[model samples]
Target chain A: MRIVLMGTGNTATVLGRLMKKCGHELLQVYGRTSSSASALASELETNFVSTPGDITDGADIYIIAVSDNAIANLAGELKLGNHLLVHTAGAVSKRVLQKASRNYGVLYPLQSLRKEMDDIPPIPFLVDGNTSEDLTLLYDFAKSISNQVAKADDELRLHYHLAAVLSNNFSNHLYTLAEEYCKAKQADFRLLLPLIQQLCLRMNRYSPSTLQTGPALRGDSATIELHLKLLEHMPGIKNLYTSITKSIQDHYRRTDN
Target chain B: MRIVLMGTGNTATVLGRLMKKCGHELLQVYGRTSSSASALASELETNFVSTPGDITDGADIYIIAVSDNAIANLAGELKLGNHLLVHTAGAVSKRVLQKASRNYGVLYPLQSLRKEMDDIPPIPFLVDGNTSEDLTLLYDFAKSISNQVAKADDELRLHYHLAAVLSNNFSNHLYTLAEEYCKAKQADFRLLLPLIQQLCLRMNRYSPSTLQTGPALRGDSATIELHLKLLEHMPGIKNLYTSITKSIQDHYRRTDN
Candidate 1:
């Protein structure tokens, strides 16, 4: 499949590499910045372009892997004849690319990507297309790189994206706060790695609520109070701690009743 | 070393089994309920006792692996002559066991343990002892079961415990909330597992603050507003979503400034 990768950011770099690894013909790489576009294009052995107007038109798919805010504007600037156009965004609607092409879709990979990761795990691509034929094409393209591919419409994709935010973004922030707490108290942050790893591994076997353990889940008010006292210096963490505790407690209380 | 396992709950079962596996002589298992106590004791090929008064007097160490609230009271009930007494609790102070024995200490494992895990990972044991000589004995015992061991005082342990709460308990609650959202929206929750696993694995290489990604961290309020709108019916999740988004934004704002 001939493809054009339309960004040089994290998603673009990772996805472009995966496509090339799967023996797809990456025709060109385009980005607002010439340096990043040229760098990725060089690595993929593809041509490079600086602007959306300069993007070549003969590719089977034009994947716009830019920022969410940039997707619509970039899509509006490009006109990819009968070739499929797709945006690799979670929150953005597939219709946003309709202005750019007759055949537009979404290729949302539900993962927080890092360009430097040597071994990207099997990513689950949630795909959507303007038509049945286009959807089949996208699924085949997705299957070429990943075994985990499924059809997800705009509405369901958004909800899954929201869940991704909770699972990936919010959870990573909590790790940031945990690292800060450990550093402040002369405790090794690495000590928490086994616990964190085990917690995620347990999710595979048990429902998270069933595996939940802590002062908040146990309703130990005394320990909760102590944790609040411990976070007195960091108001942001304190507020987060308090709110999440209340949410967890409230959820369990409602479920029990 | 002869050891007495006090309490037959999750921690006791797992830790007792680990100690026995490491070739330590588990002298007795003590708990309020004879059934649970005998069950674990039988597994460890040790005697069982229903009360603290019946706890064997000659063990080198008595590990009180009960709930945090029960630790102080349980420690007070047991009088172990000059033998070392330790409680496997993060938030509780080692001093709580001073009444039970002159050589009282702490052997807190900073991990979310489940009794059913056949192969336990090397757990990080945060040890605290009243005396240097006593600390050596505890360290040696900890080394038998785990390669990771460190001396963390009460205040430090509390901070580490606070960090663990954020990393493990609070994060697991977010997963629960995410799973709830997925179930409500008819999206497969299993699809989110790879993303979750990759996020934590990224933590091993990057500080979470640096690895953080999402609409919130990107300062994408349009997407945030849409998510908030989508979460309108689930007020508990909505509030959590709003507060965490604000916190992530605030963190980046501070770091950038």
Candidate 2:
């Protein structure tokens, strides 16, 4: 299968490498930045293009891995006739490429990517298409790159994207807050690593709600108050601490009753 | 070290196993329930005692690994004349063991433990004692079981405990919410696992704030509003989505300015 990667960000670079490794013909790499595009193209031993209009035709699949806002504009510029045009974004609709090509879809890799990653992270690729045949093709292409692949339409993908934000992005912010809080009190943030690892490992076996442990879940007012008092200086954390604790307490209370 | 485990909970079971593996004599296992105490004791090939008075006195370390609420009460009943009495609690003060023995300390393993864990997780034991001699002894005992051991006083330990709650417990609730939201929308929860694991693995290399990504951090009100609308039915998640997004936005807003 011939593939054209349209972006040089972490997702684009890593996915491009995985495609090449999986024996796909990566025909071209495109990026707004000429240097980035050339660098990725060189790494993948593929052609490079900076302008969207210069994107070569006749590839089996053309993946627009650009930012959400740029996906529509890039789709407009691409002149693919009947080639499968897919945007590798969770939030952006596959319809963004409707005008560019009759065969359009999405191939959203549902894991954060790092350019330095030596091997493909166990990325579960979510594929969708405007038509059943296109969806099958996209799913097959995704399966070639990763063992974990799923078929999700645009609306369902949006819900998943939202869930990803809550689970990955918002959760990471909590970690930031925890690290800072530990630093403020001169406690080693390293001490929290094992707890984080264990919590994640537990998710493989149990629903996270059952595994929830803390002052908030336990409704231990004394410890909760102590934590709140300790966090009085940091207003952002204070609000987060108070609100999340209330949410947990309410959850347990409502469920317990 | 001849150790007497003063509970049969997850912490007690795992820690007792680790102690035995590290060549310590698990002299006796004590718990409020005779069955539980006997069960754990048999596993570790040690004696079991249900009565507090029956708690053997000659053990070198009496580790009161009970619940936080029962720690002080259990410590009261322990009759370890001059042996070091340590409570395996992060938030509880070492002073909780003051009545139990003249030489009292803390051996708070800063990791979530489970009774069925086949291999000991990398337990970063946080040690503190009433005196330098006791602290040294407890630290050595902790070192035998885990390579990652630190000397943190009760005050510092409390802060770490709070941070642990935020990082481990609170973050896990977010995963729970994410899984539920995905399930509500008829999406597979497994799709979010890779993302969660990547976010955690990234923590080893980067501070979570710097790694933060999402609608909130980007201040994409459109996406944020869409997510909030999707979560309107679940008030608990709705509030969490709104509040955590606001917190992330505020954090970035302040830092950026």
Candidate 3:
């Protein structure tokens, strides 16, 4: 597949490299800035264009890996001439690319990607297309670079995007908050690393509900009170701690009853 | 060290087996219930004592791994005759065991433990003793079973325990809620597995604050509004979604400013 990569951010750079590694011909890299476009294109050993008008129409498929807000605007500028045009975004609908080409779809990578990462993690692509043939084509193309590819329509993709926010973004925030708490208390945050890793390992075999273990789950009000007292000075953390604990208790109480 | 293990729950069972494997002499296993005591003793190839009076005074260290509420009661019953006694609890103060022995401390394992787990994950032991000498002894003993050992007083242990709850328990609840959301929406929760594992891997090298990426962090109100609308039917998840999103926004806003 001859691919023209749009955008110069994390997703674009990582996905562009991945496509090249998997034997896809990256025809050109496009970025709003010339330096970024040139840098990424040099990395991919491909030509690049700074302007949307300069983007070549020679590629078999055009992948827009730009920010969610820019997808629609960039789609309107691209001239795909009925060639497959896909946008790699979770929140945006596939119809956003309707005017870009006769063959349009979505190729959402469901993993957190960073361009500077030395080892690319496993990417699970969530592909959707305007038609059955386009869907199958996008699926097959996704399969070339990843072992995990699933077809998700706009609604389902939005659901997953929300879930990703909860599981990945929200959980990582908890970690960030915990690290801050540890630092403030002069407790070695590194001590929590083993437990964090253990939870990840346990998730593979057991449901998170069954794996839940804490003062909240045990309904140990004594420890809960103590923790609250400890965090009395830090109102933000205290609020989060209180709300999450209440949520956990509420969840289990409802489920158990 | 000749050890007497108390309680028959997850922590007691795992720590008992670890102690035995690390060449510590298990003198006895004690539990309020005869069956539970016998079961754990048999597993450790040690003697069982249902009553506290039957507990021998020969052990160098008596490890009480009972529930938090039961710690004080169990400690009152035990007669360690000035032997090194410790309770494996993060919240409870070391003073709870003052009556049980002249030398008492905490041997709180910072990792989540389950007796039924096939593999025992790395347990970072946070130890505290009544005296400097006792602290050193407890530290060395913990080091025998775990490579990660740190001396944390009651306050620091409590802080880490709180941190553990936030990072492990709360984050896990997010995973649980996300899994439920996926199940309801007919989305594959398993697809989030790679992303989840990647976050854990990234945590080892990067601060979670630096790794945060999503609608909330990006301040993408359009996607956030769409998500909130989609979650309107599920009030519980919707409330959580709203609270966490606001928290994320508030956090980054403060940090960036």
Better of 1 and 3 by TM-score: 3
Interface RMSD values, listed in order for every candidate: 0.8, 0.9, 0.8
lDDT (CA) per prediction: 0.89, 0.87, 0.91
Rate residue B8 of model 2 by lDDT: 95
**Candidate 1 segments exceeding 4 Å error:** A51-54
Q: What is the TM-score of chain A alone in each candidate?
A: 0.95, 0.96, 0.98
Order the numbered candidates by lDDT, best leading: 3, 1, 2
Best by lDDT: 3
Off by over 4 Å in 3: none
RMSD of 2: 1.3
Q: Rank the candidates by TM-score, best first.
A: 2, 3, 1
Q: What is the lDDT of residue A172 in candidate 1?
A: 92
The numbered model that scores best in DockQ is 1
For model 1 the TM-score comes to 0.96
| Cα lDDT of model 3 by residue, A57-152, tens digit | 788889999988889999988777799999999988999899889999999999999997998899999999999999999999999999999999
In TM-score terms, candidate 2 sits at: 0.98
Tens digit of per-residue lDDT, candidate 3, span B1-257: 99989999999999988988899999999999999999999989989999999998888888999988899999998777778999999888999899878889999999988999887789999999999999999999999999999999998898999999999999999999999899989999989999999999888889898999898998889889998998888777788888888889989998999
lDDT measured at residue A90 in model 3 versus the true structure, 0 to 100: 92
Please give the lDDT score at residue A183 for candidate 3: 89
